[model samples]
Target: MAPLLICDNRAEVERERFVPGTPEFRRASLALFIASFLTFANIYITQPLLPLLVDEFDITPAVSSLTVSLTIFALGFALLIFGPVSDAVGRRPVMFWTMALAVLPALLAPLVSSINQLLLIRIAQGLLLAGLPSVAMAYLGEEFSPRALGLAVGLYISGNSIGGMSGRVISGMVAEAYSWRASFLVMGIIGLVGVILFYLLLPPSAHFKPAPAGLRKGLQDIGEHLRNGSLLKAYSIAFVIMFSFVGIFNYITFRLSGPPYNLSPAAVGWLFLTYSAGTISSTVSGRFIDLAGNRVAVILGVLIALGGVLITLLPALWAIVLGLLFFCFGFFAVHAAASAWANRQARRARASAMGLYLLFYYVGGSFGSTGLGFLWHARGWPGVTAGIIFMLALGLLLGLTLRDKD
Candidate 1:
C-alpha cells in the first residue's frame, strides 16, 4: 500500500509538468528567457561604460571596473541566500518580486553624484537580481519534463547571451550619443516591461515540493554538494570560463578605445555582436550534447575558446574581432555543457546546486573584472592573455576529469 501510494504521487507530479508541445511550456520558456535577459542585461550594461566612467569619475581603470565587479560580487553572495529561500518559500514569488524590485536600482543609477553612490546602487541591484538565476534552473528542473529540459536550458542561456550583448551594445551607443546615465535609464525601462511580461506568462510552479526550511538544512545541502567531487569539477570549470571571458572583455575596451583603433564606446559595443555566435552555439549545444556526450563537447569548447584567445594576439583589428567571435562561440558551448552537468549531477536541493555554481561563476567574473585590471596596467594585452591562458589550461585539465556518465 505504501509503495503504491508513493508511485501514485510520483506519477501525478510527472503528469503536472509542462510538456514540450503544450502552451504552458511555450509560455514558461519565453518567460524564463525574458527573465534571464533582464537579469544579464542589467548586470552587464555597465561593462562597456567602464572607460566612460573612468573619464566621468576621474578614476583609474581598476576603480572604474568596481561598478561591474562589486555588483557581481554582491550577486554572488545574494545567490547563497536566495537559492535556499526559494527552496523554502516558492520559486515564482521570489523570482517575480525581486525582479520587479531590481528595477529601482537601475533607475537610481542615473541619479548618482559620485562613483561610490553608483557602486552602491549597483550592489543593491545585484542583491535583488539573484532571485532569477539562483532559482530558474531549479524551476525548470521541477516544472519541465525531462525530455524538454535540455532545450529549455539551451534557450534560456541563448537569452543570456543575447541580453548581455544587447545591453553592452545599447549602453555603448547610448553613452556615446548622450551619456552613461541614459544607458541605465534605458535598462530600467526594459526591465519594467520584462517584469510585467514575466508575471503574466510564467505559469506558477505546480511541481515544486518545498524543502524543509532552515539554515541548518541549507548548510547540510551545501555541504553535500561540496562533498561531491563531480560538482566541484563543474564549479571549477565555471569559474575558469567566467574568469577568462570577463578578464578579456574588461580590458579589451581599453585596448580598442586607445591606440590605433581609437574606437568609440559605440564601436567597441558593436564588436560584441560576436556574441551572436553564442546564441547559435548555446541553442545547438543541447543537440550536440545528446550526440557527443558532455566530456567531448566541453573539451571541444575549451579548445575552441583557447584557440580564439590565441587568435586575438595577432596585431590587427580583424584578428581581434575574429577572435572574439570564436571566443563567444566557445564560451557558450562550455556554458551549455557545464550548466547541464551541474543540474544533472545534483540529486537533491537542485536550486542550491545551481546557486553554488553561480556563486563560483560570478565570483570568477568579479575577480577577472578587477584582478586583470592591474595586469592591463602593467603588461597590457599580452599579460592578460597569459593570465587567461593559465586559467583555461586549468579548465581544460578539469574538463578532462569529467566522465561521460555526467
Candidate 2:
C-alpha cells in the first residue's frame, strides 16, 4: 500500500528537534517516560489483584478478569477520540489533565462497595488514562529528531515495562499485607506525584501544527490509516502479541495461586520481577531497530516469545519464571519495534495513527484477559497455551508481511 502523505512544510521537516544531551531534550524524554510509566502502572494495578477481587466479591475467574478487561476496553475506544483531539488542540494538556483525572478513579477504587462499582471506577480511570499513551508516541514522533526518535520511543516503552512490573508487584504485596483497597490508594498516590512531575518536565510542543478538527475529519483520518495495508499489518501484530502476553499473565495468577503451587498473592506478584528482561530489551531495541530494521526485530521477538510460551509447559516453577522472562523480553521488542514503525509510516495525523494502533493493542488485551480467562476456567493452562500459540503463529505470519521502509 502507498504511504499516507501528511508531511509538514519542507522547511519545517528540516527544522531542529529535541536532540540528545540538550536540556530540553532531557526534559521532554523524562516527561514522556513518566507519562508512560504512570499510565501503565495505573492501568495494570488491578492485574495481580484479580484473584483477591474474585474471592472478596464472590465472582468467578472470568468475571474477576473484567476489572482489568473493562479498563482496557474503555481505554481502547477513548484513544479514538483523544488522538484527534490532541491533534486538533495540543498533546501536552491532553496528557496532563487526563493523568490528573485518572488518579481520582484510583482513589475512588478503595471505596467501591460492589464489583459493579469497582468496574465502573476502573472504566472511568481507563478513559482518563488514554490521554497519555494515545498521544505520547505521536508527540515524540512529531517533536523528536529522526535520529533520536527510536531511542526516545524505546526509553518511553521501557517505562511501560517498569511501570507494569512495579504496579503488579506493589499491588500484590500491599493487598496481601493490608487489603486490596489499600493497593489502590498507594497507586493513586504514586500517580498523583507522576502527574506533577510530567507537567513540570515536559516542554510544550514546538513543532506541532494543528490538524483539521471535527468528528468527520477524525473519522476520515482513521479511514485513510485503515486503508493502508502496511499499517494494518502493524495493528494486527499488536493485537496478537498483546493477546498472547495478557493471556499468559492473566491465567498464570490462577495457576500459581492454586493446587500444586499455592503461592500467596505477594509471591505471585514478585514473579513479575521477570519484567526486568522487557525493560532491558525495550531500551536496546531502539538501537537494534536502527541497525536491523523493524521486520527482523518483530520476527526475532515472535520466536523468542513462542519459545517462552513452550517453556512454561514444564511443571517446575523455575520453568514458569524462565518462560515469563523470555515472554516479556520478546513482548517488548515486538511492541517497541511495531510502535516506532507505525509512527514512522504515518505521514500526517500521527496521533490518530497511534490511536488506531492502541485501539487494537488494548482490544487484544481485553479479549485475551476475558477470553483466556474463560478458556482457563474450562480447560486450564494447556488450553491457554494452545490459544497463545495460535495467536503467536498468526502474529508471526503478519510480522513476515511488514516491509522495511525505503
Candidate 3:
C-alpha cells in the first residue's frame, strides 16, 4: 500500500509540471535573465574604469588592478556565507535585501574622498552583490522544469553577458564625458531600478525544499562535493577561464588608452559592445548543449577562445577587435554550458556547489589579474596571450575528460 501511494504521488507531481514554450515559462525566464544581467553588470561596472582609477589615484598599474580584483575577491568570500544562509531562509527574501543593499556601495563610491575608502566600499559592494549569483542558480534548479532549464539558464547567462558589456561601455563613456565618479552614480541608479523590477517580476519558487540538516550537514555536503572529481574539474575550468578573461580585460583598457593607440575612453567603451557576440553565443550554446552533450560544447568553446587569443597577438587594431569578439563569444558558450552542468551534476546542496564554483571563479579573476600584471609589464600582450593559451589548453583537456552520462 505504501509503495502504491508513493507511485501515485510521483505521478501527480509529474502531472502538475509546466511544459516548455508556455507563456509562463517565457515570463519566468525573462525575469530571471533581467535579474542576472543587473546583478552581473553591477559587479563588473568597474572593469573599464581601471585606467581612470590609476589616473585619479596616481597609482601604479598593479595597484590600480586592485580596484577590480578586490571586488571579485570579496564576492568569492561572501558567497561562503550567503549560499548557506539562502538555504536556511529562502531565496527571494535574501536576494531582495542583499540586492537592495548592494546599491548603497555604488552610491557611496563616488563620494569617497580617498582611494582606500573607495576600495573599501567596492569590497563591501562585492559582498552584498553576491546574493544574486549565489541564489539564482538555486532558484532555477528548484523552479524550472528539466526541459526548460537549459533555456532558462541560457537567458540568465545572456543577461550576464549583456550586463558585463553594457556596464563597461556605459561606465567608460560616462567617465570619458565627465568624471570617473559619475560612472558609479549611473550604476547605482540602474541597480536601484533593477531591484524594483526583480521584486515585481520574479515569482516565488514552487519546488524549494528546505534542507533537513543544520550547519554541520551543510558543511559536510560541501566537503563531499569538493571531493568529487568531476565537480572539482568543473570548478577548475571556471576558475581558469574566468581568470584568463578578467586578467586580460583588467589591463586592456589601460594598454589601449596609452601609447600606440591613444584611444579615447568613448572609443574604448565601444569596444565592449563586442560582448554582444557573447550574448548571442551563450543563448545559441544553451540550446545546443540541451541538444548535444556538454562535453562537446565545452571542447568547442575552448578551441574558439584559444583561436581568439591567437588573433590578439596581431598588432593591428582590426585584429584586436576581431579577437575580442571571438573571445567574448567563446566565453559565453563555455559559461552557459558549465553553469547549467553544475546544477545538473549536484544532487544535493546545489546552491553550495554553485557558490563554491563562483568562489573559485572570482578568486581566479582577482589573483589572475593582479598576478599577471607583472607579465603584462615584462612582456606585453604577447606574454598575457601565452599564459591564457596554456590555461585554455588545460581547460580543453579537462572538458574532454568530463562524463555527461547522468
Q: What is the C-alpha RMSD of each candidate to the true structure, in Å?
A: 1.9, 3.9, 1.9
Q: How does each model score on lDDT?
A: 0.91, 0.91, 0.84
Question: What would the per-residue lDDT of candidate 3 be over residues 277-370, giving only the tens digit for each residue?
Answer: 8899988997899999788888999889988889988888899889989988898888887778888898888778889888888898888878
Native-vs-model 1 lDDT?
0.91
The superposed Cα distance between candidate 3 and the true structure at residue 47, in angstroms, equals 1.7
Q: Flag regions of model 2 displaced more than 4 Å.
A: 1-15
The per-candidate count of clashes, in order, stands at 0, 0, 0
Measured on C-alpha atoms, candidate 3 has an lDDT of 0.84
TM-score: model 2 vs. ground truth? 0.96
Q: Which sections of candidate 3 miss by over 4 Å?
A: 1-18, 212-214
lDDT for 256 (candidate 3)? 87
Model 2 alpha-carbon miss at residue 256, Å:
0.3
Give, for candidate 3, the lowest lDDT window spanning 10 residues: 14-23
| Winner by lDDT between candidate 3 and candidate 2 | 2
TM-score of each candidate?
Answer: 0.96, 0.96, 0.96
Q: Evaluate model 1: give its TM-score.
A: 0.96
